[model samples]
Every structure is written in structure tokens, then in C-alpha cells.
Target: MIKHDVSHFPTILVFNTTEKDKTSVALIKNGSVKISEKSRRAQELQSIVEELIDNNHIEIGEIKAVAVLEGPGSYTGIRIGATTGNTLHWLYRMPVIVIPGTDISEAAERLMSGEEFDVTTYFSPRD
Candidate 1:
């Protein structure tokens, strides 16, 4: 469930932990990107989020949504990402958009549109 907030700057927190032992987070604020990814995803997820948020000067009220990569990939990675997104949803009462993880391109396209990609095969419905 997403609560509408007109008082704050709308920002999306996008994260993908679909690959094994690799995690990445992207905080999209005002067309600026604060992102980090490494093999240390598990150990660094929280810190990465903090760094992105702090560096971007995002307040709790500024977060409009959290978009996370839902998986056809690593179970642990998906679980961790889901957990973090859920935590954010609980804390902020913002909507959590679960993006299908078949390709990062779709999510990226949705986040910011300028350049375009050729369409590929459509994915199945989420299980």
C-alpha cells in the first residue's frame, strides 16, 4: 500500500540483489543518482542505503516509493532485498513496487526515460 504525500519531494529507492553475492542499491532523487554495488552486498546493504540516503540528503518524508527487483534469481539475495524494502515500507508507509527481475532494463526505463531499448519477450506473471 502506498500513501500519497504531497508535502515532500518524491523519490524512488531502487535496489537489486538478484545476482549471487552481489547487491546494488540506487537512490534516485531529483534526477541525481547515488548508487553502489559490490560482492559485499549482504554485509553492506544497510550501510549502502544509509550512505545513499545521507549523501543525497533525503529525508523520510522525501521518499515516495521503494522499487526493488523481484526475482527469478538468487533466493537469499531476493529475500534480503525484499526484507529491506518491506522495512522501508513499514517505516515510511510508502508504496513498494516489486519489479520483475528478468532484466534491469525495464526497471531503468521506468525510473528515467530518455534513451530507449528494443522490446524483448514478455515475462510470465509473478508467482
Candidate 2:
């Protein structure tokens, strides 16, 4: 098996707003889940992220990449997650991963394995 250099992705922030009521956020570090939270509402996404990181004593600068689920679910939710991830990428110049499915752990693993994703700034989920 080939080994991948995932040193650059020490910490990854993940957003999964594909499910309307189950919107969630996670922080993956060294291929382990440091924190995971389900947002009570769509508007809570930002606060959820902040709370998770703050509680885990993780600083924003420690995050090397951002992963967001590019939905087959709620359009509004997809927009929220995608917009947040894209905005972070633009601000921090970090890689933004667009996941096409619901498996957050799988996506994180792919990143840890040095898999590349095509990230786009705009998102328009099917209604």
C-alpha cells in the first residue's frame, strides 16, 4: 500500500447541511473525530462551528482544510454549508472539499489519503 502525506491536513472542518433538520458540523484531527455537532437550525451553523472548536480548544488557524457536503437534499441547507465552506476557503486560502454524499467520515478519510476534490464557489442544489 502507498502511504500518503497528510501532514498538511492535520485538522479539517467539515459541514454537512444536506439534511434539513440534521445539519451537522465536525472537526477531524489526525483522522479522528475531535468534535461533531448537529445544528438545531440552519442559522445555527456558524455558532455551532464556533462552539465546537472553542470547546475543543482548537484555533481556526489550525484547520488546514474545509469539507462540505454538496447536497442531494434541502437546497437552502446545501447553500448554507457550501457558502460557509467557500467563504472560509476564500478567506484562509485553504482547500475546500465538496463531498457529493452523506458519509462525512469517508470524505475525511479520502482527504487524509491525499485525494483531491474539485471545489466550486457557487452551489445550486436541486429543489
Candidate 3:
């Protein structure tokens, strides 16, 4: 439901560990992507992120943006995940986008079922 220019950033880092019960981490670049949702997100978040990028052979500098599934979940987890994206933005000088989590699940489900998914714009705090 938030809007901003996403064209400036091609590669995106997605964070979805807002829910304590269900969590995931994803890294996306062009047509290559990796995602994991095997639980213990707190312990696996960092490593998954590293491995996702590493396995994909994407350099850290190539990540042009970050997207976070924000809210409607564990408060502490959301803050921690969002904070990580914020830190990335601060270090990389790219945009950090915060999106509503409620719809993200539905979108993901649809995608898994080979259904159409609407491409929505993202919102950045710096804007």
C-alpha cells in the first residue's frame, strides 16, 4: 500500500521474519532468487542472508535495495528485521522499503500456486 520509485534499484534484499511462528528470508537479483522458511529465523537469519547471496554469486555492492515485510507480527522480530534493512541502507546508500506483511503472505501463496501476482511499488523511509 506504500509507493515509491523502485526502478532505481534492480537487486533487492527481502526480509520476512516478522512472525515468530512463521518466518523467512529471501534474496533476489534479476531472475535469480533464494528463500528459506525452516524456522529458527533468529539463528538462521544472518547466515541465510549470507548464503543466499553467496550461493547466487551476487556481490554485496550489487544489492541496490532492501524490502521488509513489516507489521502484523511479532513486534520485536519486526523491529530487529527492519533494523537490519535500515542498517543495510545506511551502509549501502540504497533504499530500504517497508511493506505491509498481511498481503505478502497471500501474494507468496499465489506465486507458489503459479497464479498471477500483482507487482506493487515499495515505500522507502528516506523519501
Candidate 4:
């Protein structure tokens, strides 16, 4: 298990794609939203996140965890967000926390408590 002490590393990369037409990416620090960007271009999600990180001068490693807002919104958007979060988890070995709603504080609490969720298991498209 990874140590997710927010005080040690307060930066958390958040992805909120629960909206029908737009995707939101944010840098969260110390339980507060630091910087954020929204895009209607769902296909540009990856680039948007990259640019946001770059613009904020936040390194990938500096992010304590990846918090993804899972569903109750756009299907495709949710898929994209989860996939990106999972990819980041795999590539960088960062912990991925799935937020069922838009609550960032709740996710932070879960992280602090060391409650782990399988990021990949949350998204399964209904056929």
C-alpha cells in the first residue's frame, strides 16, 4: 500500500467527467481545489490534463493520488476519465481513488484512511 499522507504530499490530480458535454480536470491540494480546467472536447481529455499539469508546474510524481469522478453522468466521459486514471495509476504507480459523486473531500478521507478501491472495476458499460 502506498502512503497517502496529504500533509506530506497535498497535490492530487482530479478528473471529473461526469458532465454530459464537458470534462473537468483539476489539481487539488490540501483538500481544496487549486487549479482546474474544463473542456467540451472529451477526446482531448489527455492533452487537457497534461497541459493543466504543465501549466501549474506540477510533476506527475508530485501528485499524491488520482481521484476520478465515476459516473452518474456521461457514459463516454466517465469511460475516458476512468481509463485515463487507471493508466496513470499503472504507469506511475499512483493510487487511484474512485469517487462515486462529485465530492472531493470524501475521496480525500478515503485516501487518508487507506481505503483502497480497484479503479478498473468501477466502470463497466451497460450494453
TM of each candidate vs. truth: 0.72, 0.80, 0.72, 0.71
User: Which structure among the candidates has the greatest TM-score?
Assistant: 2
Candidate 3 lDDT over 1-127, as tens digits, reads 4355453445777777766765676665554456766566544567767877888887989988777776677776777676777777777776766666634444233233433222233333233
Q: What is the C-alpha lDDT of each candidate?
A: 0.64, 0.73, 0.62, 0.66
In candidate 2 the C-alpha lDDT for residue 87 amounts to: 84
Task: Give the poorly placed runs of model 2, Cα more than 4 Å off.
Answer: 1-8, 119-127
Superposition-based RMSD of candidate 4 using all C-alpha atoms, in angstroms: 4.4
Candidate 1's TM-score: 0.72
Q: Poorest 10 consecutive residues of model 3 by lDDT? A: 116-125
| lDDT of each residue in 3-107, candidate 4, tens digit only | 233334477787877776676777776655644556475667888788888887768888867878776777887788878877887788776766667544555
| lDDT accuracy of residue 55 in candidate 2 | 87
Per-residue lDDT over 1-127 for candidate 1, one digit per residue giving the tens place of the 0 to 100 score: 2222221324778778787777778777766566677677555688877877787776767878776787778777777777787777777776666676634445655566533222212212233
TM-score of 3: 0.72
Task: Give each prediction's root-mean-square deviation over alpha carbons.
Answer: 6.9, 4.4, 5.4, 4.4
- For residue 66, model 4's alpha carbon misses the true position, in angstroms, by 0.3
**Pairs of residues clashing in candidate 3:** none
Which portions of model 3 miss their true places by more than 4 Å? 102-127
* Candidate 2 deviation (Cα RMSD): 4.4
Task: Give Cα distance to truth, residue 11, candidate 1, Å.
Answer: 0.4
